[model samples]
Target: MATYAIGDLQGCLSPLVQLLEQIQYHPEHDTLWFAGDLINRGTESLETLRFIKSLGDRVKIVLGNHDLHLLAVSHGFGKLKRGDTLAEILTARDRDELMDWLRKQPLYHYDESLNTVMTHAGIPPCWDLHKTQTLANEVENILQSDRVDDFFATMYGNTPDKWSDELTGLDRLRTITNYLTRMRFCDENSRLDLESKEGVNTAIKGYAPWFNYPTKVPHDCHIVFGHWAALEGKTQQARIHALDTGCVWGGSLTALRLEDKQRFSTPCTLNRKKT
Candidate 1:
């Protein structure tokens, strides 16, 4: 009955398989949590998606920015970038089923007993778990509705720069998605600074790492996330874990055993395709 959290697979199925073998994962008894980017950059997008789909109730995933991009691209709301492995998925025979399943995944997950919370990226510094879950439901409702197309249409943006109860409609959805997927840095006022993607030394002016902000972090609970591979798998906080070890860039695919937080990693064989 172990639960294991894995970092961004990015369509690198070989390393994923190796890591699964290393952990001796049992579908009948174990659960797997994915930090998203389940497909892209690597060569086996179709295979990766199918593997996950076959997992039934044994797996859980939070959507990443790349995952959202794949959904938008599939529906013609966005265009695929060159070097993206998503084409394999878009052309798959079971494309509709795969895409629909992906869209239904929650943006965040929480476990009460373990006090572990998972999202593709870090939660905003200004948001407590209650507010974060509430906002997550707002988008989830749209994603699960007939208006889903309209939701994806308004999905891209960094506007409303900070969270406010006043934010409504598409602006509010965009802000929530950014916090759950693209967020990294924030200013003193807790406004999300979407432009900075560099390491700690090169932070965009006045912005600091979301976890390093002056206020008390969601430190009372264990937080597991990916998407910031440039952290190169480093987080200064014990309760926070950075699992994206840059596997798509020739680093290792990482997995954390939930019961005792034991780690398992396997070297990647990446082709370095940009997405």
Candidate 2:
């Protein structure tokens, strides 16, 4: 059996369908690991969510910022932004089932056989693989519980930009969520500079892409992540894989077969639509 990890879908089901065809995906023998952002931005948010949900056990998904945002909006926490296309999902009859299934997804997925870890955003340098899993579990636990509202209430902030064991309650969960979902630029100390979203070149003096710093991640462990589309699927580190090629922004949808590291892609029709 083989496994493939795909980049952010962001509601672009067409490119995803094309990429799956290009990969010659066989659900019976292949497992698909999605890099999250499965909805929002493009025109088919509702359809995309349904399609991915229909995959059932054949796929693994990690929640991204947009995915979390969709949850928050559904819970009446956040408002839809300018380019957001989540209204269809918000009003769909099966939204409850879809959102329930979504919140149950983990924030990070690790496959020991492949020696790979998948997260929507890269792991924080300070947190080793074990600690990353522990923290991610904290958010996942809350996301699937009745306390989920507490998470969304305290979710939208960039303060307390570093990690510490002393952090408690929603702050602790939010810190873990931010690193796993929205992180981009961070320092060696894991101090996140949440404002910067540009490419590595504009990384603001003390900060750099999360992958640039010396991380506690094992030398042999591969990290497959999405969320920073500005990188355009390029990271100098061999073990660090960036799969988000900005398909929702008129770029392309990409998938990496973990067995051979072969990439399959399809051009998106949405040409630079201000994502």
Candidate 3:
């Protein structure tokens, strides 16, 4: 049995299908791990959601910032920005079912056998694996609860750029969500620089990629993430994988085979306008 970790789909289903064909994926014998952003920015949001949902137990996924934004927008908390392509999902007959399934998906996934942790974005430099999982659960609980609307309402912010155990309520949940889903660079003290979305070379002064922070906690596990398409599947660290290859922006859709670390990609046919 093989396990494949795929990058952000961004509603680009054709590439996913082509990549799966290239990898010769077998539903019964293979497992798929998605680094989130399963919808939006492309033209097939509804089809993408339905296809992933149809996979059932064969797949594992974490919510990306785009996914969260879709959830919040569904509730009228977030405004639909230009270039957004999630209207199909919001208007689908099974929209409630799909949204419920998405909101219930975990913010992080850990595989003990592989000693790998997958999040939509990189883990915070300050968090060890245990702290990471625990904090992820805190947000997961609320997202799957009656207070989910409250979460959506306050989920869009860059405040409390640093993490502290003393943080309470929505602040704590929002902070955790940001780190796990939207983070790219952070300062020496682990304060997230939420505005910088470029690659590592362009990091703002005193701010570095989360994985490059000097004070980062050590972890024996490998990390896989996909929010930063600018990295183009390169993190320079063998254990850290950045699999988003910008498929929605005419780049290739990438998949990394976890067992052998073999990568397979299919050039995207969709030519989406960069956002």
Q: Pick the candidate with the highest TM-score.
A: 2
The whole-model C-alpha lDDT of candidate 1 against the native structure comes to 0.87
Instruction: Give the TM-scores of the predictions, in the order they appear.
Output: 0.96, 0.97, 0.97
lDDT by residue for model 1 over 1-275, one digit each (tens)?
A: 89999999999988999999999999999999999899898888789889998999999899999999999888789787888878878888999999999989999899887889899888777778888788888888888898888878988888888988898888889889998999888887779888888776668778888888643445578889999888977889888888999998889999999889899999997676654
lDDT of 2 by residue, 1-275 (tens): 87999999999998888888888899898999999999888887888999999989999999999999999999999889998888899889999999899989999899999999999998999989999999999999998888999899889998678999999998888889889999999987999999999899998888889998888999999999999999999999988999999999889999999988988889997542254
- The residue ranges of model 2 lying beyond 4 angstroms of the native Cα positions read 271-275
Instruction: Give one digit per residue, the lDDT tens place, for model 3 in 1-275.
Output: 99999999999998999999999999999999999999889878789999999999999999999999999999889999999998888988999999889988999998888778899998887888889999999999998899999999999999999999999999999999999999999987789989989888988889989887643435566889999999988988878999999999889999989887889999998877456
Model 3 CA deviation exceeding 4 Å by range: 214-219, 273-275
Q: Which 10 consecutive positions of candidate 2 have the poorest summed lDDT?
A: 266-275
What overall lDDT goes with each candidate model? 0.87, 0.91, 0.90
Which of candidates 2 and 3 reaches a greater lDDT?
Answer: 2
Q: Best to worst by TM-score, what's the order?
A: 2, 3, 1
C-alpha lDDT of residue 170 in model 1: 87
